[model samples]
Target: MTWEEIAKAKKASVDDAIPSEWRLEKNPTANKVRNVGEYLDETLPARENSITSCTVTELAGKISRGELSAIEVTKAFCHRAALTHQLTTCCSEIFFERAYKKAEELDEYFKKNGKTVGPLHGVPISLKDQVNLEGIDSAIGYVSLVNKPKNKDEVSNIAKILENAGAVFYVKTTTPMAMMSGCTSSNIYGYTYNSYNRLLSSGGSSGGEGALIGARGSPLGFGTDIGGSIREPSCFHGLYGLRGCSNRLPYCNVTNSFAHAPVLASVIGPMAWDLDDLKLVTKLIIDSEPWMDDPKVPPIPWREVTDYPKKLCFAFVSDDGAARPHPPIERALQMCKDALVAQGHEVIDWEPPVSFIECRDLGASIYGADGYKEIADECAKSGEPIVREVMVLAGNGTDLPIGCSHVHEHWEQNKLRYEYQQKVDKYWKSTAQQTSTGRPVDAIITPLWETCSFKCEDIDMFSSAYSSTFNILDYAAVTTPVTTADKTLDSKDETYTPISDHDRAIHEYYDPELFHGTPVGLQVVTPRYEEERAIYLSGKLRDALSERR
Candidate 1:
């Protein structure tokens, strides 16, 4: 079969898997509905609406107390998730029957034992397409990988940990081909629209997870980040996403593009609607001692950080110098600074000795070290063109990248990465002299992207300067949603001059009308292996922002 034929059959199969009653009567086109999240909330039956709206913690608590059954929670999420997929194309795999079976078992266990199986008993959790599951395809948006399903031996370690905690999985979300784009789109699943605003791109490669959770199809889900996959989508949807340091959470058995790329490693983490829920899942996985099963993971126990200082200092980066953030982002940053200051915390301008431009360029070279050969080879198996959004990885979306010709050249790039890390680490330590608390800044707050989100096809127009720099530094970071784009409050700058050609393109791309109502968020950064501290600061910031409002 042609690639198109294979893609059609795969899509059909997913649609068929959804029970007929759960499917939407008509899928709304972009012109008809711009916010599928609000659409679903208004249309779903009251019981399903309330069930899906509950947080991970809330659902788990109710189930443990027997106020809600595992089967009912699973059924509600399945119905809502099926409708979400129909509207946004967010799901890559749909297996409601399997989820129901799991839920039934959990319910039965509770009835017989007089107690819940685990903390997450009966709660529905979604997975990105990259997470392996038995009898399901990880596919990661390659049509060539569609028919081939995973076996029992191939289940991801993280999935196993969650299942042990009594989590139920119903669907796996979509991604760009080979999980290689900033926006999710592939020949197999097409563009996964933003649940908040369907006309905009749902940031990728975790884009589908963003769309699903943003639409409240699932309370919480897992997404992997090589550069900014987890953070960008989280920012776009007003969700909290953790991009933990490398192997802080297990990636064992997870399908990925560069499974063994040694120069720069990708990390898997959680994205959730509530700050406490994000913390709960992170600690739960860490508490499982994942290192015993996945040697790559560090054996760091979940450190509870309850004794933090009352007055914390934060470093704020207003611009990355490569591309100036759009108006909404500028306003959001100011709002954060003001909120923290009002809470008696110190917020200072950050001037790192190293440049984000240097870090980002080095990351690009490392990511393309193999010239994206794996992506090309996989596409060749079924003959699907690389999705247009990912063409920037290759030359201008047309020519393939010129890879390093020798192992030594790759080593030089890795060497440069280490040097960058050291310089930034030193600079961060040097900040002790600048703060009133006589310590390094607790965390650095900055924009995740220059804009809240862009039109689906315009992803290539923006640079990954803000988020990818942290990835290269190997720092633990989390995204915190601040506010939304308001046309009246965030007008385009008429007097600002362009700094560079790329900056000019980004500056010219802004239209207050086009981006209104989209979510805006900033990332909180801490040193390497500091996921706990990063998440703590993020929650504090969320509190400050809420109190200010």
Candidate 2:
């Protein structure tokens, strides 16, 4: 069928599936648009200029001291998120009514008990679309998945923990179709944009969460990362995002693709505006003992580690040795190096031997190993048009199903990945020889991707090797925004030469002028299951950069 025919059929199917109770009787209120500055001005008092600038720790302290009520704090965030979603299309579902009700409950609890409800009491949290809420749709950008009632109770372990701890759920965010690519777009939501610059993408499949937090719409949110889904968007929007070790947080009841396929290195974790908030959310979830409910989760408790030495070491890589980063990304790396050195930390050039190409190719094979026949079957059930990126994964219309032999070949690849992990561990251990403190680097700093952020059609050209390489190695990676895209300084180099058509096309997407003020992010990577260490190191890096400024 033609594209037009497909579009009409999909619309009709969606209309037919809408619940009778939810069918609109009248037009809904038109969404409002506002920038970050305008939003802060309207919601906060004259003396509260810093309200928009403060971290979650500061906000929590104020609430605890009775200077702010839960309802007031929650309202500020919900209003801001509504505006952000209007401008950037960051939300897949909005629950302002429910959030307000929860906020009121939190306020009553504090008043009666004379204490805070929990560590994150009154804080508004956003979630990626895949997380299950009792009544909310867990539609991860597939029209077919929309409005489908859960077979059982949809109270995800993570959601239960957050609710018990006093978090007010204001919104559930969007993702790309099947969340298969790094750009956020789907037939259901169209596209999500960077709040900082409307022309650029927010990054995906956690793009909506990234945009929401970056715009200060919510203080904290959760996103999942398979191939830089969390880290890339976090970097693109200038926020703090963590791709924790798989199973560190509960994943049970969360909707995902290829449910029958053996798990790979994908993980779910928090995204926030500041490092301290990231720590706050991480501690709460891990302390909640998610393993009790989700069999897949490991029984690991959050550990409080002491601070490292004053002088620390870092291994820096501007690129994954696959493709060079754009000018803005290059500048962000330099700024980080300079900031660290100025703070009395040791910085050294890193040249790891692993090939990012191999890492990315293998990861893609794992993702498409089923040849997406299952995904196509699901799409057909609802008669929703397959998204463009999903088409890419289906591989040039072949759509051929992979047999048992292909599955066995993937098992062989998994063994090779295990071998690769050992080599990386050895390489990290050897870094001690080059450090003045005689200890290996605390973390490796690398770009999240080769570009700041891309437009929709341009996303296919860029490889997610920078972040995906860490996933393949099963290392913990944290994304921290360093600077904004500066068009004058970030222009494409005229002297640049292409390694291939893909390389050149990727380079051509860098319109620094269009991407100006967009967040340029860096990744901090540590060994697997080292979330505490990762969080601590991320805090140190945030402090180091703040001190420099």
Candidate 3:
């Protein structure tokens, strides 16, 4: 059959498979349904207020003070998430029933003990579809993988830890096919849009999680990053995300694209609306000792170090020269540097010893070495058109797959990555001598991407050296929004000179007005495996920016 014919058949099959309860009236008028928020307030008592408007900490305080019950909190989040999914197409599976049941159990425990279950007690958390939860599908946007029953009790390492700590799970969020693209759209659930704008991209492969959190559907969620997956979406949606050192959070039961790839760079980490929430979730997850359950996890617990001095050293980089950041991003970087200097923190211009361009290329080769044949084969079964971003990176479904023999070359690249990391380490160490604090820079503040959220087709040509370089070095990186895209400050640089063809295209893609109000995020980088420090410093940086504003 022709591709168009297959696409039609797939759509028909999917339509027929939808449960009757989920079907909507064709061309229904506004009168046919209540606004989701209003419906939730009417049906659920806890949702009389907006659950999305509060932070995880605020919710915890309410629960502890007896002002809220676990069931009430879970229901409020579920209601909001259901609405978010409807608006942004963020959720892959709804687990409201299971979440409510768990919430009831927590309430019962509290009633008997006169105390909450744990730190995360009644906090509702969303998971990417890659994290398996027993009966739920772990399709990761591949229809061929759908409906495959879990052979074993498929509990994710992170889920197990969170469950033990009393966190509630309400929904499994969506992802892109193969989870390799910068935009989230799949044959399984359709396109996910920016909750803030809807007309623009949400930034992916963690796009759904970003949209859900940004829309206030869930206060906290988890997303994995290999390239810019976690950070880019977080940046675009105005959320704080940490791409922790690989193995800091367990990934054993989690499904991903490079399942068998020897050079493991991708990592799963937390996403939150606020920096404190990110820190709270990170501490709770790490304290659970993921190493016990997942052999690959390192034995790193939450460090209670308060060693950060009042004064800090910061390194700032606006452009990596691989892809010059758009005007708004450059301004955001300058604003952050100025804020830090005004706060009495030492700021230094950083030119890394090694080129970021080389790192970006190496990272892409490692990630796309399979030539995405696995993704294509999976997509063929689903018969969904490849999303614009994926097509740009891997071409229109005709690229040949990389041969198995290339594995040896991939191994050599991994070794080179180690050497590159050591060079970074040396550079970081050298900063101590140049600072008044007598310590190396606490973190390097850099732009998360060239644009707030690039047009889907432009993502392939846009260099993601900002986040990818950290991944190559296995450094802990935290992303925080400094400002949104402001048309006045983000005006095009008419006098700008092209750094390269790729850089010129990236420059042309910028539209200050189009991206207005989109989050412009900056990264805070710390040493490898020092996730606690990264979180704490991110909190400090966030506070500094807030104070300035």
Q: How much is the lDDT of residue 136 in candidate 1? A: 93
TM-score of 3: 0.90
What RMSD value applies to candidate 1?
1.0
Q: Estimate each model's TM-score.
A: 0.99, 0.90, 0.90
Tens-place lDDT per residue, model 3, 1-549, is 654554345435434433344444442222333123333344444544556567899888888777889898887777667665666778777767788899999999988898887887888999988988887777787767776644456777788888777889978888887787888877666677777666667888899899888877788999999988899889988889999998888888888887867675689999988888888888887777878878888897788758668898888887877778888788888888778888888888777787777777778777777776776676777576556567655644335344443777877888888888888889889988888888888888888877888654445566578878887888899998888788887789889889788888888888866787777888888898888888888777888887889
lDDT by residue for model 2 over 147-171, one digit each (tens)?
A: 6645547767788788788788888
Candidate 1 lDDT score at position 338? 95
RMSD of each: 1.0, 4.5, 4.0
lDDT of 1 by residue, 1-549 (tens): 999999999999998999987777777787788888788888888998988889999999999998999999999988888888888899999999999999999999999999987889999999999899999998998989998999999999999999999999999999988887898999987899898888899999899999999999999999999889999999999999999999999999999998998989889999997989999999999999999999999899999988899999999999989778999999999999999999999988889878888888888888888888888788889998877877775558776774544788899998998999999999999999999999999999999988899888887787768888998999999999999999999999999998999989999989998888899999999999989999999999999999998
lDDT for each candidate structure: 0.91, 0.77, 0.78
In angstroms, give how far residue 45 of model 3 lies from its true place: 10
Lowest-lDDT window of 10 residues in candidate 1?
397-406
Where model 3 places Cα greater than 4 Å from the true spot, the runs are 1-47, 380-388, 395-401
Q: Give the worst 10-residue stretch by lDDT in candidate 3.
A: 27-36
